[model samples]
Target: MFTLIAAMDENRLIGTGRGGLPWSGITRDKQHFRDYTAGKSLLIGRRTFEEMRGWFRREDRPIVMTRNPDYDPGGHCRVAGDLDDVLALAADSDGEEIVVCGGAELYRLTLPFADRLVLTLLHADFPAREGGVFFPEWENEDFVELRREDFAADNQASPSMTFLYLARRAGSEHADC
Candidate 1:
């Protein structure tokens, strides 16, 4: 399953800068990402790839989609210049699943290509944040609630966090990797 895993807020904000993941000061979000992506192939944008160097040195390594070919992170981090190239690489990989990590524009581009979504909904309204990116809409009916964890208001992580494991309806995918 090609899955998109992201932590987001109610107002539809993911990040503000070029490629920042705007999770509201939640430590659990990092854990969530790390756990889900531990032994998998993580797809990311150019800036995200740069920010997250040496973190995803998993057995499978990670694939990064960027505009530059000079991005040589060495060891396991492969760069795909565009969506088609990224899809092609994913298509050929032996792994049954791929984790689509984001930086906004990359997420939007990946939406149409994904078969599942692993989302974290943070129930805290944020103040005036700078311009950021949002996740593309996938209807509620298309998801299956696999796991959910709720946090108290004073919790160090978040007030109320919901982890969603959403599978695209059968036959939604054009091809399988």
Candidate 2:
């Protein structure tokens, strides 16, 4: 199965800049991300991979998508030329699910193939142009929310957060919208 995971602000902003995230102090959210993706195979964009240079553990398998055929990821992580190559690698993986880790373009490109979405929604909005890179717009009707947990604002971050697990409903069409 294919899964997409991300943390976004109220405005659906997944990123604040090219190489950084908007909010920094999401300790719990970070743990959730690690726990959920630890043993899975990840498909991430080159920029995302660069931003996460040393963060990956030994057990994690990361496939970076990039157009440069000679780009070296400098670790066990592999490189793919495009989404089709990423999917082909995932198809050969032994993991239970393949996680689509981000950078806006990769998310938009793979949304149609995702079976599940694991999102952490921050309750605050960081307005656009503050380096806002959006998560692709999606329809709620396409997936069934399987679980939700709310976390109160903590010392590390001011905004409360909600963790949502959604599975694409069987028979739902995967449209471009």
- Per candidate, the number of residue pairs that clash is 0, 0
lDDT of 2 by residue, 7-50 (tens): 99988998866458887867898999999999789989999898
Error in Å for residue 115 of model 2: 0.9
Candidate 1 has its poorest 10 consecutive residues by lDDT at 168-177
Candidate 2 lDDT = 0.86
Write down the lDDT of every candidate, Cα atoms only. Answer: 0.72, 0.86
Best by TM-score: 2
**How high is the lDDT of residue 70 in model 2?**
96
Pairs in clash, predicted candidate 2: none
Q: For model 1, how does the per-residue alpha-carbon lDDT over 98-131 read when each residue is reduced to its tens digit?
A: 7888867777777776788888887875542566
Instruction: List the candidates' TM-scores in order.
Output: 0.82, 0.92
RMSD list, candidates in order = 2.8, 2.2
> Model 1 scores what on Cα lDDT?
0.72
